[model samples]
Target: MSTPAPPFSGFPAGALSFYAELEEHNSRDWWLAHKDAYERDVHEPMLALLDGLEDEFGEARMFRPNRDVRFSADKSPYKTHQGALVGSGTVLGYYVQVSADGLRAGGGFRAASSAQTARFRAAVDAPASGLALEQVLQSLRRGRFEVLGERVKTAPRGYAADHPRIETLRHKELMVVRDFGAPDWLSTRRALTKVRDTWRSVRPLVEWLSQHVDSDAATT
Candidate 1:
């Protein structure tokens, strides 16, 4: 049996301002100076959010705040946001992030490995599976979720440029996003509820991708 999630009050006070200030002063010095506020206003509330989500969404993993700067010219010392994943293993599962902009949530594999991509294209080209995927994309659009991915200008080699499913075939990765504009509710428990509802709405698409495009899908 699953344990009940703990009651959560809301994001800690000044969570938004902390991110905003971090954006302006994105340095180790600035973060060290205000680390206490980060703990109280940002990290703690993120933990509460994850705790509240774990029961229904599975284990939630918070990302590190440090930015990987080894290969990038823009070397900001920290991320401008906090992101977490609910679920385990290689599946992309439910994700939620809070930034100075607002909260964003939803799920899907952002990119498929070459082997997975071949399988995904096979399914996308097949009549039955292709139709099913189209319907899923349509449903997501109707629900105000933005379907996103890196796309090639032309259809992949085997598919015709003008093929009925060509637009989808051009995609190298796929995911959905639901932006919950920063509102008063973001500072309350309602934010958790909002994220839960959006995740639920997109769960089918997540499942479909796991079943069709994940590495294990090839075996099945």
Candidate 2:
């Protein structure tokens, strides 16, 4: 009979080492050789982490390790890192990733449609909602989370260049992230604590995006 996996204690150091080597040797042959280590050291630990978070954070889905190369020039067969998402049905959610660099955790929105973008920019242009988002970002920044997003060089089509929240309106994607490079805590249960705390810290932004951008999608 096969042995069952142990509960998540934390990701092993081997997880980090495995990814580090994968980065240097990103090829089909190398990955095939290391697949066993990947399963034992990386995949199972992440599952345990997600299981640990589900009670509070909702269930999370890990991204497939295989890369879709049909539309891309870089046709490497696999992803360099593994990532997962919680509360992701809408445009907003919490995200986490682990790799050679260590752990990264945060929350916010991505893959917004034109309609969602319209709602997002309209909310940013308004007084109450605009101020609320700004405040959430400020609060997260104060707590050491880095607010990040893709942006246009100029304001989107109807908003003025000098509009008060032009910068925010330019965002196509927005999120807050923290990188915890291979720390001593990574190989212990404490890694869960750090990820949980970071996700909680950024939850406001994700909530704000859901309220302003995602909430209306059901109707329109």
Candidate 3:
């Protein structure tokens, strides 16, 4: 097996502007020319952030870069940017996708799928695990959160008007969300504080997600 990378310390400032310029010239050739900069500026910093979180929370998995293009035509090899943080419970971590236009965030202890949702629901619903469920639900109820995305006036074309996920999300708003939670009040406070201290490192990337085009409408 490949050795896992270490947790990240934080993101680099100006990473968002670098990505924005690259997106303006979106092309395989451009990516090849500028991929190194992305690694140095964006990816590496994100890796540091993830590594830092991992030191405190355990390993965090990264999403694959390959877009599932069977449902769409706009296939770009690399994402504009990335972000993530630790969550409470066995889930351990959450991911954020930062592009030019918006950001969205979600997580489950189980794999990310319908089956995982079902499993999460079951876990939360377990009578014997009421305390555990209460911990998760309580964190969600805190509500001081951020969604990264642009302000849109209408729904984008090619998606069904009533698609469940689309209907649930506000139109013209695309954001990568990072839900925060902890095992206890002290831990929660620390997590949020650390996130705040590092906010400048990741905020630009999150802002970028709201400004760029989302290529995963069908799957999103």
Candidate 4:
């Protein structure tokens, strides 16, 4: 029988260095030459990390290293960073990425359709659910998690510029992120603890979306 993959022991320092070099030499030849290091330092570590996290976070997905350049102006052949999603399937959930910058973890709906956006806005407009969401955002902010999302300068079509929950309503795609760039603990088992804590903190936000937004759309 095949041996089970070992538990995550944190990412190696080389993972950061590899990405730092990739940022400068984002070419096919550079990538091909250093592919072994990518596997040893970056890819494998991520897989192990995800495996360690699966128990608490459920199945996770490792994104491809290749960037989709078909419709983009900046056609970089390869992505500068590696990323993954946890507890996600057809719906949005948690995300983590590592690069020269180090680690980033957060959660939200990324590609909410117009219908979904309408539903999200509706939930935010209601006093009970909207207030609950605001509380969650405030708590995350208190914990220093950065709230990020695409938004309009003014209010969305139906919501007033003066609306109380306009900021939340204006979000086309909402996510919260914590960026820990090259911390000393990054290359140790502490990385696993840190990531788990962060994801747990993000759970309420994810649950809010699931309960107030995704659940209905899922069945339809």
For model 2, state the Cα shift of residue 197 in Å.
Answer: 0.9
Reference-based TM-score of each model: 0.89, 0.92, 0.50, 0.94
**Per-prediction tally of clashes:** 0, 0, 33, 0
- lDDT, candidate 4, 51-78, per-residue tens: 8888888988788898888889987788
Clashing pairs in 1: none
Question: On residues 95-208, what C-alpha lDDT tens digit does candidate 1 reach at each position?
Answer: 888888888998876553677677777888889988999999899999999988788888798888778999889887788999986888898999989988999998887777
- Per-residue error for 138 in candidate 4, Å, reads 0.5
Candidate 1, residue 166: the lDDT equals 91
Clash list (residue pairs), candidate 4: none
Ranked candidates (lDDT, high to low): 4, 2, 1, 3
Q: Give lDDT tens digits, candidate 2, residues 29-138.
A: 99999999999999999999998898998988788899888889998888888888887564468888999999999988774567877888888999999999999888
Model with the higher lDDT, candidate 1 or 3: 1
Residue 60 displacement (Å), model 1:
1.5
Per-candidate local distance difference test:
0.81, 0.85, 0.43, 0.85
Residue 179 of model 3, lDDT score: 41
lDDT value, candidate 3, whole model = 0.43
Measured by TM-score, the strongest candidate is 4
